[model samples]
Target: MDSKIVLITGGSSGIGKAIGIYLTKKGFTVYGTTRNLKKYPDFTEFQLLEMDVREPQSVNRAIDVLLEKENRLDVLVNNAGVGITGPLEETPNKEILNAFDINFIGPLNVIKSVLPQMRRQGSGLIINITSIAGYMGLPYRGIYSATKGALELITESLRMEIKDFGITCTCLAPGDFATNIAAGRYHAPVNNDSPYKESYGKTLNTIDQDVDKGGDPEEVAKKVLQIINTKNPKVHYKVGALLQKFSIVLKKVLPDTWYEQLLLNHSKK
Candidate 1:
C-alpha cells in the first residue's frame, strides 16, 4: 500500500502541529499548511505549505499545489480556527464575521477544494476539529459557539452526502484543550459603559479558570490518529476531562430551566 498522505490546516501550532508530528512518526506523509511557515520551519517527515483558508483563491491555489506535488490526497484535517470572546451584544458585527470566516467558511473552502480529488480516489477522510462549545453554548462566547454550531451542521450534512463517494466526514469536538487559542488575536466590541460589563468580566474570569484545567493538546492529537486508523470511524468524536463530559450529558438530559441555571451559576463565577 502507498503511504497515506495527510493535509492539515493550521498545522503550524496547537493540535494541528501535534497531529502532524504524530502522523509523520506513524509513517504517513504529512503536509501542514499555515499562513506563517517560518515558525514551523522545515521538517524531514512533513512538508509545510502556506495557506489562508479564509481566501477562496488562496485555498484553491494551495490545494492545487499539493495535488501537483503529491499526485494524491488521502486525508484532510480542517483545524484552523479563531476564538472571539465577549457577550453577544458586545461583539462587533465584523468580528463575528471574522469568526465565521475562520471557523466555518474556512473549512468549507478546504473541503470543496479537496472533494473532487477525494471523490476521484473513491476513498478519503475529512476531519473537522470542532469544539465542545459546538455542542453546547457557553457564557460570553455566543459568537464562537455559533460558528462551531455551523460547522457541526456542515459536518453532519457532508457525512451523509459523501458516504456514497467513499469519503468520511468526522467531527472531532474537543473540550477545553491547553492551547494558545485564548491568547490568540481577539477583537471585542468597545465597552462604552455597557450594562453587560460586570457580567462579561465575571465570564472572562471563569474562562481563565477553566482553561487552567483544560486537557493537553497532544493527547487530543493522539485521539485524532486513532480516529484516522479506525476501520469504521464515528461521525462525532468527543474528548475532554470529566467536567466536559458531564456538561455535554447535562445539556442533553437536564431540563431547560435547570441548564439555564447551571449556565448562570457558572457565568457569575
Candidate 2:
C-alpha cells in the first residue's frame, strides 16, 4: 500500500510539529502548513505549505498544491488555533471575534477546503485538535474554551454528516501541553482599576504555570496515531495528565454546583 498522505494545519510548531514528526517517522508522507513559509527556512521534518486557516482562498490553494503533488489526501489534522485569555466582560469585541475566527472558523475553512477531495477519494480522516479547557468554562480563558467546545460539537455533527461519504471526523482534546501557544496567545490586559483584576490575574498566572509544567506534546502525537490506526475511532479522545482526563469523568457524575465549586477551588489554588 502507498504511504498515507497527511496534512496538518499549524504544523510549524507545538503539537502540530510533534504530530508531523511522529507521523513522518511512522512512514506517512506528511505536509504541514504555516501562514508564512519563510519563517522556517530549516523545517525538514515534513513538507511545509503556506496557509492561513482563517482564509478560504489560502486554504484552498494549499490543498490544491498538496493534491496536485500527492493526487490523494488521506488525513487532515485541524490543528491551527489560537489561545485567548481574559475576563469575558473585559475582553474587547474585536479580540473575541478574532479568537473565534482563528480557533473555530479557521478549522471550518480548512475542513471545507479538503472535504471535496476527501469525498472524491471516498475515505479520509479529520482529527480536530481541541482542548480540555474546552470541556468547561475556565475563569479567565472562557473565550478559548468556547472555541474548542464549539469545535468539539461541530466535529460530532460533521462526523455524522460525512459518514456516508466514507469520511471520519473526531476531536482530540489536549490538556495543558507544554507548547509555544502561550507566546502567541491573546491576553486582555489586566488593568489596575478593573474589577476582575485580582482573580483574573491569579487565574492567568495559573494558566501559564500549567502550560509551563504541561505534558509533552508527543503524547498527543501518539494518540493521534492510535486513532488513525483504529478500525473505528470514537468521536472524542483526550490526552493529558491523569487528573485532567478524570476531570471529564467528574463532570459527568458530579452535581452541577459541586463541579462548579471544584473548579472554583482549583482556580483559587
Candidate 3:
C-alpha cells in the first residue's frame, strides 16, 4: 500500500469525487467524505467517511478516525462548497451567511481538525479548492466570489505561517467545470418591482451555460495528481481551459475599465 493518506471533503460528487477516484488509482489511500454514508461511492479503492464540513464535530470525528487508522495524513483537500447567485441587494441575508459558512468557514473547520495530526507527522499538504471567481468578482455571484476571495487570502497567509513546520497550504483555483453546482445554486426570488431582475436572469443563465459546457473534471484530477507527486508544489494554480486560465492574467494587467468591460461583455451584463 502506498503510505500516503489523503482526506478530501465533499467527495460525494463533482470535483472532489473526481480527485478521490483519480488519486486512488495511483495507489494513494484516499478517504472521501459524504454527508450521507448511504450515498458512498461504489469504488472499492475509495473509502467513504461521513462528514459535514459545516459541523466542527463532524470534521473532528472524521479526522480522528482517519488518523487512528493511518497514523498520518499527507494531504487534506478542502473541496466542500456551495454557491449562491443573485443581485447583491436582493440576495437574502440568510443565504449570504450560509454561503460564507460553507465556502469560507467550512474549510477552516477541516483545517483545524487535521492540523494536530499533520504537525505530529512534520509534513502535510492543505489544498483549498477555491475558484477563478475568487480573483474577479462576478455579477449575481458576488458573495461566492467574496467567500472564495477570503479563502485565497487565508491560504496566502497560511502558507508562510506553517512553512517552517514542513506544512504547506495552497489555493487551487479551478475555472468553470461541469459539476452539480448549477442545480444546487440558491437564487434569490425576483420581486415584480426589482429593477435588476432582467439583467440578473440573463447573467445567471449565461453562467449556467458556461458551467454545463466547462472543462472536464478529469483534467482537474490530473492536475491534482501532478501536484501530489511533486516534491514542492507552487503556491497557486489554475486548472481549466486556456481562455479561462488566461483571464486571471489579463485581469492583472488590464486597465480597470477594460477589465470591467471584458467581464460584462462575456456575461452579457
Best prediction by lDDT: 2
Candidate lDDT (C-alpha), each: 0.87, 0.94, 0.88
**Tens-digit lDDT track for model 3 on 1-269?**
45589999988789998999889888889998988887554656588899988899988988888888988899998999998899988888999999999999999999988888788889999999999999998877899999999999999899998898899898888999999987777988666798987887788789989999998898888988888777888889889988988999999899989998899888874
32-109, model 1: which lDDT tens digit per residue?
A: 898866666555447888899999899999999999998899999999999789877767788889999999999999
Residue pairs clashing in model 3 are none
Q: Model 2, stretches more than 4 Å misplaced?
A: none
Where is the poorest 10-residue window by lDDT in model 2?
260-269
Candidate 2 pairs with clashing backbones: none
Per-candidate TM vs. native? 0.94, 0.99, 0.96
Give the poorly placed runs of model 1, Cα more than 4 Å off. 38-45, 185-192
Model 3 spans with C-alpha error above 4 angstroms: 41-45
Give the CA lDDT, 0 to 100, for residue 257 in model 2.
94
Candidates sorted on TM-score, descending: 2, 3, 1
Candidate 2 C-alpha lDDT tens digits along 1-269: 79999999999999999999999999999999999999999989999999999889999999999999999999999999998999899899999999999899999999999999999999999999999988998788889999999999999999999999999999999998999999999999999999998888888888889999999999999999999999889999999999999999999999999999999888867
The total of clashing pairs for model 2 equals 0
Candidates 1 and 2 compared: the better one by lDDT is 2
C-alpha-based local distance difference test score of model 1: 0.87
